[model samples]
Target: MTKSISYRFALCICVLFSVANLSVADTLTVTWTGAIGELETTIMADTSADGTQAHAVYKLESNKTYLQRSTIVLESSCDIVGAAYGTGETPATIQPIPGDDGASQFAGWPAGNIKTYGEDQSYAFKNLLFNGVFADGSTTLFGVLATYGKGNTITVDHVTSVHNQVITYFCFGQEENWTLTNNTAVQYSCYPAGMYFGGFWWGGGGGWTGTVESLLIQNNTIEGAHGQAFVIYDNGLVNRTEGEVINVDHNTFVNIIDWPKFYRHGNNTRWTNNLFVNMAANGQTRNAANTNIALNNDHVGGHGKTATLYQGACTDSTLLADGNCWDRTNRNISYQNNAWMDTPELLDMFAMEPWCWDLPADSNGVVVTLCDTMIANQSKWAGDSTMSMFANGVYMSNNLHMSDRGWNLDPVYITAQTTRTRDWLDNGVHDTHTDHFWMHQADGDKITVEWPLPMDFSYLATSAAATHCTHGGPVGSTHHMDHPAGLTLNTNPDGIVASTFALKQNYPNPFNPSTEISFNLDEIADINLSIFNMLGQKVRTLTNGTKPAGVHTLEWDGRDEMGQRVSTGIYLYTLSNGSKTITKKMALMK
Candidate 1:
């Protein structure tokens, strides 16, 4: 829809409803209109004194991309506690203030000039689809002037943009007086359109005092940078700047040609769980490596066809390279504690192959062998959970029941499977999908699947309860099962339902900060409740103890093992008794 029509419709309805008397609620919506074009934003916010609550919506003309010299400040008199900013599709959730005192203001300055509110006072932006036209590097997409104070919190989690010629996502100035945690740039890749620099850049200097200590860079996926993915420069912010901890973890960078430079200032940094591919001419570079630690990272396609690993002026006991893997060889391409040298003359151990810096034996990395030609072909039919290939045909699996489709099939009971490939066929021939017979017991205890290793395509298949089932396919031609019959409920002649356990849906489905999870027990049983991220990594363990024969509730404060608040994302929580295990998915908004 066009912005003018959408804006007119919203304004007309808002004005129409203004006459009706309504009870006061905790939420308020404030709108801002730009002078030129149809540029407007409406934000709904929570009115608690210190509670973090804000959501914004933007409407712009069809051709118009950005607004100039305009700012939208929310209508709230209460002091700013915490704030978050992102797109409407992906709301940037506010992380908890670890030591908030309810009266503390998070923004650096008091509310004043409207233009500087986003940086000076606390504010957020959403639904901004701007195509930046920046030639010189002087302009910043959003600049936050650093002012000294405590209890400051800012997050820019979900932003989508292009034409980042000189566009910086966030620019912070001098004086460090806040803790930035639980920030993310996930799922979407920040592609470099024009002249490229860092996708997310920080630094115009920081405070000398020890207010800000740590920077957590996690879960970002970026593509093709001309400069560095992250750039941190020094302007004398702190004396021993290298002593401050910087964690760069769980990010994927594709085709960063020139730089992923962690130069002089970012000495005290740990690069972990990162995947680097196509670091073209300037393969990964590290300077002032006295305090840098790189571990457990996977890298492929360096400066040239020969995968390159570069180090500058790093001496013994200075650079710690361990448990890192690379696509360097035909097989077993993994290493641990890879010894590196300063120059080719120092290659006395491996004389013929002087570039062999990593120790030959006792390597700590795992390598898998695959030809360059086979990598693309084999990747198509590999790693998917639902589609498996045998010597004869391809096997498939799905949750939807399709037994009535004139094919011999069995029911599949597994609910948490994501690898089921739909409509997969091998060599345009026979295929079997989800033919495992699942038998549900009287109690909600154990459900098992019984299937033979190899099936005779010529014979008739049998069904449960002694119901004779015949194979149906192209007559006289060999074929496998076509579709899956989902879970089948087992009942006795009396028609009484039986269940030993039940897990209820979490209250307040999309929640902020905290939520309650409840479950029921038919009899006394030991239980284990845990939370896992989409990547299957356990975020937190809620409980590991015994429960009685009743309903029990547990509250999660959206924290991990170290009591740090987690980012906004989809999480899975599982309730596992000894006999049966059930899992459900939930969303953490902030």
Candidate 2:
């Protein structure tokens, strides 16, 4: 049936509504009549003094590309095929203010700018950017910003901080629930980050209580930053927080002179599955040794491919390096398929610098290091409850490449976890994907994870070697369809298409009860998914990984940060790979 003009226009409007009000979908048009500032402010106004909000909306004509500067700044999830920048003053550098109160302005700054907020407010944006542009106003405007608080949910999504400098976008808070996935950060720097988290006033010592638990950063492409890519624990912020499960997976890093600085005393935070290509891609003409890749600058991955973390230390922490594909995975692991859950391969034992001392520098010749000390053993350290792979300090397991090296972040400290493992094959004749099933209890107590073995993904790395993958093809080829002989879009070219992303809607949305939200991947890349209330506050994160694509899910019962079921209302589910995006709406019927 031929559609009428009004009906056609309504369909067009619906296509325009990404995450926000769907009603506007039928009336909006993508025209530039020089109206940018007010629209951008509308998005900014969504923020709160309490710091408990985050949002992303990929509103675009499915056929059209390119995002406007105003839309990029105002909207959370968008694809700008062209150039985009934000209005506002370029942020001046902000040093650790000695006496900034959590509720008031940043130390020594004017009023109205809340220096400290809750973790619940910082909803990490996970969006994809393809052939696009981004502009952040000053280091303070926020590409990523986290504020840990009594609120329990850290949100990080596929958001690329690019081509703008002022205030950084990432921050941290008291209770950590950080998840940064598949976002690209390029040619942007100032303040403390091209990509960063300015939270917890962590320069002096680890402050606050409770482990910054369940945080993951994966599958991101970052380049060119003025300050450190990561910053943790101020000198005064240190407070013994243990069992923090931090994961860095399947991401690529380049042109970042200064990497993340660490407190070195905390038992939380894990780094793995990420590869740094040009460790010295920024500045290394006279400083060759400095050019090498070093987590704390103790060693280098070198030009071709070799990187080191933890200043060449071999101690048992929560870190396992597998995403690098080669650098960190070179360590010895004895267990089979234990690819990414192993310790790092340090460069030189004696030459290893202490972690705090070997930080990277910004474009300006500034040496940055984290200094808060005098932490009490009980600070932030939880006695129990950590949902991670290596739940303990360090252990060894047989692996695909080498013998295992580090301890597992076990959710429970018992001898073993009630776990399940499944294998997917690419056989053109008899490939099995959904058939492999096991017993599941539906109880949310145990951590459930699904992975693709090295042999499973070998097709991408070894198509010529028939013995590698069951139904294999060359790298970047379509060899992963259900039938090995069939060629399909394994993942989209932009990485944002529905085919490229394994997205799922929040289950039991608008329910007085809860439901399960799930997704499946076809390959290994960083992933991020979040649940947001209609007002744009991030409520929870389901999963983030640099894991091989298969299937995955997380349960979000109808509840708020306080563990109370929220009022009956509308909500949205967002997923991204920093290149593509998909969103679904669910309801919570009180």
Best by TM-score: 2
Lowest lDDT 10-mer window, candidate 2? 413-422
Off by over 4 Å in 1: 1-151, 174-199, 204-211, 234-244, 280-590
Residues 365-456, candidate 2: write the lDDT tens digits: 78765321111211111111111112233222221221222222121211110111001111111123222121121242111111110111
lDDT scores in order = 0.31, 0.31
Candidate 1 per-residue lDDT over residues 348-431, each given as its tens digit: 111221111222233657542221110111111112211211121222121111122232211121111101111111111113
RMSD of each: 23.4, 21.1
Against the hidden true structure, what lDDT does model 2 obtain? 0.31
Lowest-sum lDDT 10-residue window in model 1: 414-423
RMSD (CA, Å), candidate 1 to true, equals 23.4
